[model samples]
Target chain A: DVKVTQSSRYLVKRTGEKVFLECVQDMDHENMFWYRQDPGLGLRLIYFSYDVKMKEKGDIPEGYSVSREKKERFSLILESASTNQTSMYLCASRLAGVGELFFGEGSRLTVL
Target chain B: EDQVTQSPEALRLQEGESSSLNCSYTVSGLRGLFWYRQDPGKGPEFLFTLYSAGEEKEKERLKATLTKKESFLHITAPKPEDSATYLCAVQAGGDTGRRALTFGSGTRLQVQP
Candidate 1:
């Protein structure tokens, strides 16, 4: 079975502060993604990395950035946390070209 | 643009009651349709993947069927453990291929014991 681990399960940050959410996948998948889930909005992708050091912006990537320094690790960074950024963030990984995604437990961020 | 829509935002059922959840999708080219079950505060768990119309996959009491434009997840003899938010997603294939999935708003199911 594939396992995706998130560094934080819950976090609170003040407005204008920078936040970091980290994810690690044991499957060594080449594709990793960051998504924010909100009520009535479903899952909106923030950024995705197909390989180390390569990133692509998704539908909603404003105020967010990503890093893939290693194959097994992906990180999501909020340049400046805002109340609007408070939501559940999910990390997922999959094999290249495979549609099936194995997800992490998710990190709930509260920006106040 | 690739899109997915799930019907019936919420459903309540007594134990042993059966029902179906619908997922409608539109894409330039359909690669696959996926079904996932998400528990509160947890990530979505993959359930089924339908590749083409007339295809069906089953796991325990859940069965998923696919058509050209839509898919259905049928739950039979529901139990409290079966209660979760069901998510539907679509993968698009075309000249502009995408690796990320387009997810629906999801259908929240509650089974009463």
Candidate 2:
């Protein structure tokens, strides 16, 4: 079975503080993604990485950045957290050419 | 733009009741349609993947069918444990590099005794 693990399941940060969410996958998948899920807006993509040290901005990448220095790890960075940034963050990974993704348990971030 | 929408933001059913959830989509070219079940506070769990119209997949009491413009997830004799948020996503054509998926708001179902 494929497994994806997030560094934290819940986090709280003060406004303007830097925050980092880490994700790791054991399946050696080539594709990884970050998304923030909201009540009515659904899951909106924040960033994705296709290979080591490579990344792309998704639909809502503002105030967020990502790092993929290693194939098995992906990190989402909030340069300066704000209250509006609070949401359920999810990480997913899939093999090359495969359409199905395996996701981590998710990290719920609270920016106060 | 590519998009996916799910109907019946919430549904309540009695145990042993049968019903279907709808997922409507619009994309330039469709590669696959996916169904996922998500428990509260957890990520989605994959259920089925339909590649073309008339294609169907099943696991236990859940069945998923696909058409040109939409997909349906039918639950038969559902139990209380079946209650969860059902999500639908579409894989679009073009060099997305298998990057991202467009997801629906999801249909939350509750099954009672």
Candidate 3:
């Protein structure tokens, strides 16, 4: 089974704080994605990486950025966190051209 | 733009009851439709993938069937352990460059003992 790991399960931060969420996949998959989930809205794609040093914006990429310096590791960076940014963040990885996405446990962020 | 919608925002049933969840989608070109189970505070776990109309896939008590514009997930004799939010996602042919899926809001299921 493919394993995807998120660095944190929970975090609490104040407004204007910079936050970093990291994800790692052990299966050498070529695609990685970050999604944010809120109460009423489903998982919304924030960003995705197809290769090392490559990234692209998803539908809701505002106030978020990503880094994929290495194939197995991907990171999401929030320059300035706000109350609206507090939500559950999920990281997923998949083999190129495959239809399934293997997801990590998830990281829940709370900004006050 | 691609869109996915799930019906019955929430459902509650007895342990032995059988029920079905619906997922409707609209995309420029269909590539694949997927179902996932999401436990509270956890990321979604992939369940099944339907590539075309009339495709069906099953795992344990959960069976997923797909059509041109909709899909159905039938849960037979669900248990307390099966209580979770079921999510639906779709991959559009136009999303080859992004390699991402658009997801529905999800249906929250609770099976009472």
DockQ values per model: 0.77, 0.76, 0.82
Is candidate 2 or 3 superior in DockQ? Answer: 3
- Fraction of native Cα contacts reproduced by each candidate: 0.70, 0.74, 0.77
DockQ (model 2, Cα):
0.76
- Give the alpha carbon lDDT tens digit for every residue of B2-84 in model 2: 89999989999999999999999998788889999999999999999899999999999899999999999999999999999
- Cα lDDT of model 1 by residue, B32-113, tens digit: 8999999999999999899999999999999999999899999999999999999999888864338888899999999999
Expressed as tens digits, the lDDT of each residue in A80-111 for candidate 3 is 99999999999999998658899999999999
For model 2, which pairs clash?
A: none
Q: Which portions of model 2 miss their true places by more than 4 Å?
A: none
Give the TM-score of chain B in candidate 3. 0.96
lDDT of 1 by residue, A2-97 (tens): 999999999999999999999999998999999999999999989898899988899999999899999999999999999999999999998887
Error of 1 at B99 (Å): 0.9
The reply for model 1, stretches above 4 Å from the true place, is B95-97
Off by over 4 Å in 3: none
What are the C-alpha RMSDs, in order, of all predicted structures?
Answer: 0.9, 0.9, 1.0
By lDDT, the better pick of 1 and 2 is 1
Q: After superposition, how far is residue A111 of candidate 1 from its true place, in Å?
A: 0.3
Tens-digit per-residue lDDT, B1-113, candidate 3: 88999999999999999999999999878888999999998889999999999999999999999999999999999999999999999988854564898999999999999
Model 3 pairs in collision: none
